[model samples]
Target: MLLYSSVGKLSAATCSGVAKNITLAIVLPRYNTAYPWAWPRVGPAIDLAIKRINHDPNLLPGYSLCYVFESSEDDSGYCSDSIAPLVAIDLKFTHNPSAFIGPGCHYTCAPVGRFTSHWKVPMITAGASAYGFQEQKTTYSFLTRTGPTAKKLGEFAVHVHRFFSWTKQALMIYDDKKSDNRHCYFTTEGLFYELQKDNITLIHLPFQENAEDLDYQQLVQMIRMTGRKTTMQAGIAFLLPKRGEGGKEGKNELKKGKEEEIWRHFPRTVQTKNLTLAVVLPRYNTAYPWAWPRVGPAIDLAFEKINQDPNLLRGYILHYVFESSEDDTGNCSDSIAPLVAVDLKFAHNPSAFIGPGCDYTSAPVARFTSHWKVPLITAAASANGFYQQKTTYSFMTRTGPTQNKLGEFLIHLHQFFNWNRHALLVYVDEKIDDRPCYFVAEGVYEQLKTVNISVLDTVFQEKEGNVDFHHLLQQIKSKGRSE
Candidate 1:
């Protein structure tokens, strides 16, 4: 089913003021920003996304999909110096932006996140790809990014290293340049973190992003000095860096030409010989550990069971390319886009995608797989919404949790406690603009009603952010004393 998000408690009449037509605002970099070439491409992409969404008859029927742009004369999308004007433009009452797109740079998105988190307005970014965004989802509840995220890059590095059984890696990164270009900087940082978890030692190599002209001979010599002896047979250098020459380019961190020179120096793709399953997960997500130790072990147990019988399976060693679905919070609609990316990067090489592991993640992920065409097999996620969403979520095959079971569970709870009275205490986000949790509260209220329990009262949190449940507690006490 589509995510039934109820943004606010607006009456049919008053709602006309805020959402007469669905308008999506975009904050792109100006033509004269840090990367002039990239900004031109960002405009067309936003236009195309708007066009596709509008043409879809099933989506937003009777609602005109309009967009507003927010950018300065020569501004790059950054957090500290940028995004304030963008946020101000969006917050305007005169046809304020219903949602946001663009301002795709990591620096700009950080501040944009601050506005969205406080206001509760949904935003989708096509440009930014920082790994830190996933860790800040609770702070930026409304933001969703289509990314070349740090986690995705890290996972790709881990996959290649694991395939070759390499225990040490040279952590190559561009020198700290303009803050606007931090997306590239953080990607290598994320790659380093992922390697550390696998007990791999990473040697740091600081290079430049725009390495146009540099001494190729010194760079080559630096590689040899690091311990990895280079045999230049063709255009490609087929060796990982030697241990001692790790920081050979240390003093030469002055230019923005590291990555380009490295590619101009060493290039070739690595290939593995195993039957691979690219399992998409949120392993880099410490907020949710459901993917690794939770569903990861379950896959192992199944494989172990299969390994015991030679008659059942022969001549095949199944291994998993565990790809990380970068997440900030539990809301993983953003995570689904990266699976499409990583899948294409390997030419749809994954056997299948395993669990996203909860209702929050699987909701959006299930819908995307219809287009992604990869089989999404969920483990711990038992949302009853799955079966009804079959048409939209065609690629999904779930093996846990059901609404009927939850219905039975609620009845059992009342039976055991001998307390027939029931109610919901929903603490809404004080942001009157909109809150996504309203639908969740409605779902719980309906489910509780189905189990034949009478709801006496519904408690809402106070405007100051804390739940004022003292009165509700007193009522429960009074009811108990009377009974």
Candidate 2:
């Protein structure tokens, strides 16, 4: 399960200047079941995201976020008996919420659908990814989701099948409990049709083959006496919640709402085959501040294309999981690369490491973790000479151009403006236990020298980012150089 909790400090804060706060109702459902949540920190993660948005004045323009955590009883599959009553009773109707978030379980979304549809309130959920909710849009007029959809899940399933080169498999549905069976029913339909189009044979069942180990040797020896069957090379089980809730009226009425309206829209296609993609958000990379968030969608787009055509990646499916990376200078909390890699190794066991973005953090991961076995793949991290020391750092690979390539860029810029002499500004912080402060400066100087650029002088700052360039500007003027 994804267990990281994100930045959610100011989720309920009212901006200092904003007189009125926009309220959102957060509905976290407590499903009475044995299966643990895929990500136990879903609630905190949402709060953290909300806090991030609230603090960014440019994002919302005129809003301070106010939200109430509403825990509703959704034990039974029937919505009216559990969810509907609690939503009506728990939520403050007078101070109308601008929107409602969550009801994470697939079954709980039904009541939110009814309420949101009736009041025309916008609803957002991070989970509850059942398929076919879009067909009944009138009831789910204002719903959204930040996670994957039923069709995407189906496509992902197809990708898994394609990855294994398996033409035959069992499709397990959770129809044992009527209320809890909605997800299984929808998943079965959605995936059945998708796989059916691909000419894959699918047998529907209500449970996993490993439900018990009662198989006898004689039964296997007879080629399955009941019927002639090809080997079931894979099994795709839909393990969704089911407690059997709501009567015919609930299904016909409130269940019409879907998570599709909440957010996230992607063009869908089924790709063949499967493989795992692991990524670490480069949050600690001081050089590229905007890199972290883009990784998620970038992975999405890559897989989207691969999945669109079964033949695009003929024999494999691509799956991606990303974890936040950090160091002392704010990459991600408690995420010093080496330790984080160890945790990930035991927990998720990624096939490869996508990145920590910057060289400082990526260096440790490649040097230590990748050497342990998993390869490290990165789009950035052009600094710190991994390419020059290729044999020494054999496991590290760059998807991006080298840092020396920047000299070519500098040469282009120099040619464009007819610039000649350059003065280098380097950050000097000799505070570490024993290491030298001018780590990046030496490399920068060498790259410039390699490109035949003449350096007029090299100036030093007390720290990397604490430069007061006004004094340096005066000295530059004394030297009478502009470039």
Candidate 3:
């Protein structure tokens, strides 16, 4: 599931010389937490594309492209059939939309595409990549896919299988059998079906995707028990004699042996003391871009490189213990992060904290690291407070840009363009701890106000699902801005 770029260009090409009042019903998920390509993350880029297309004289000739957004997701961050169909019906009657840009999730996309295909209206999406979409041609005849499909993924997996020459495979998948939550099931169904054609024994192990009471121990035991007879088990176990610094049998063990002849080639004086770094992250199963599966290997590689170098941190060896700040549902908790920090502090005596990458989760962990006088390094935690509250998070070090820097950059942008006035629409869900847009809007507002730019109005949306687009549009209409 990758978000393809040049959405504006694609949209422009789709709606070229369509009509004067050409409106596209743009369906998007409200939050980016669960999916990175959600509307909150990609909405601005889409808006900018529309803006550029509208302003360009040669592009559309006389026709100007416009969009009406319909947030496709419900409160739990899954696309809702109940919400989307109603919204689509309303948009169809009210806006008289020329086309449908998206309803990215397979759940919403399926129904919406049915409507569009019947209406002879073209609907293009960067999501809805399930293989079912490919098979259901008549239902989705007018639908256009702009992203990777599960069919291609299945083909890719087949290639991998052939390359490995594996005769048997255990296909462990997070398969939720619910209507809205069957993304994993749909994605893997292609692979499962494709593998059935091959000459290999495959075991499909389906589990609850996000159940809070999910039995992890049972899952582990099940993995061990499944296809145990056929799978070859190979591992190396180290047997260290009681001849260490604190060992009681050290004198006796020392008398029994000298270094082996093969050991003479290596430097025995290399650092032996282990320095533990607490590696906090979201769960590996979450499929987030920064989750443990993506980040853990990088951390291990870095530690490997550092520990291999004899001069780097000369007296100590580098190691890490991974801890998840998020649960199965993908919600990062402030409390969980601190608890992880306290546990790692005592258990591993960690020299530093590597993450808790979420902005909300990073706060408590940062405070803990600051109190412990150990550095908290992260590529995330880009909110304004992290940079502003220097005294509170003095030991916190960011490897990337903060909201303040973004605010500063926006200020320069406004100044360079000589933009005087603009309206601000800030979405802050009090229910959700991750309010990235709110923080960014705050920073942008502060910076823009400093230069005496006329603030027409600042609209605050408390809920993503409950945003009154009609009221917002009315406010803009009342402000007398035609653009």
Candidate 4:
């Protein structure tokens, strides 16, 4: 939740050898769209946490805390999109961090989780509520999260449903294209099933692709088909889309126009009836834009747009803002304080550093501390290759694959599929366009080259707009045959 800074004065102990210096790597997600929401809280939280840890004499006696920061800017909403580049950057750092902190989103957590699990590093995350963390029972030793569990989400839904008194006929709308949707589905359905023990009617309206437009239309159709007089309660309505601007625009249009249109068809008296809109903040801070005023303004604008719809039912739209407080509870900070304390207790033979998240801190901090060879201890980081090779090291205390894990999988695929014999690498250019997708593609290319696999041909795709898969696929096929 909240992170605070404190200073404590203590008596000096007996003299000892040089104190070990620990480097903590905090990796932050760098999507321009999501940064506004995440950085304001996460950045300040880390800064305050580190300051508090350093000031605590008992926790880190002889050693001073060093920090490494990394950023993954892939806006595609896939964990691998950001994790791969982050891990590649971490591998380049000279310091061998003892631990790593985050790849903020569940999508980023998956790849980072796999990598840390392989390297036996401690990984801790403040967010990332994906079910896989518990369902798969990841073997990574130090994996943990400070956020609410899926079951808690179910409970919240049940309360909302009970408040509405609409036992049955609940509609659930989710973005089928994203993994986050699965989380929403399970949590909502679990709650619905439990509440329905009283014999309520629940109608599941699941939309798979083009969630913004298509799904919204499907939901309206279902509402209409249920009849205008039907007092229907809807479960979590994922108004946000996976993609950045593209998704936002689509969602905005739907909630602004189509949602109201559906309401207009209903009788005026029924329209005046209360309709609850359950908005779930699956990933904290991600819902808001990355900038300060912009973040605040964007949320305000979104709400205003939704409210402008005259058809919005009379029941208040309950926006449950589920997020970690900024206060320093010490739960997250305590996890890494001991490691720093231990390093100092051991006469600083091995330095200690602690971090809160992986994608936000580790890579950047690693880059900064590469020259010192400082070790970092993290509760979690979801970057792909943070611990690859012997140079910079990260102890992923939690579960997730590093870039190497994904690279290893690619290597196995190369061997199994024999695609390594001759391959055509298609990637977007980074120098002219510094996108996370290009960075990941390049990272994968470098890994493939390490195994004596050379790219027979390279293709650069258009940077902006929708990708023309038909032409791109044909080109890839042509190149494959030529090679």
Number of the top candidate by TM-score?
3
Alpha carbon lDDT of each predicted model:
0.50, 0.52, 0.63, 0.43
- The residue-by-residue lDDT of candidate 4 on 172-270, one tens digit each, is 444444543245543444444445555666554434433233456656777667632232224444322222111011111101121111111222333
Q: Name the TM-score of candidate 4.
A: 0.37
Worst 10 residues of 2 by lDDT: 254-263
lDDT of 2: 0.52
**1 or 2, which is superior by TM-score?**
1
Output the worst ten-in-a-row residue range by lDDT, candidate 3: 245-254
The stretch of ten residues in a row with the least summed lDDT in candidate 4 is: 246-255
Best by lDDT: 3
For each candidate, C-alpha RMSD in Å? Answer: 24.5, 29.2, 30.6, 26.9
Give the alpha carbon lDDT tens digit for every residue of 158-213 in model 3.
Answer: 77778877656565554223555354555555565556567656653444435455
> How do the residues 8-69 of candidate 2 rate in per-residue lDDT, one tens digit apiece?
43234344465357777666543433322222345556567768888787877677776765
**Ordered list by TM-score, greatest first:** 3, 1, 4, 2
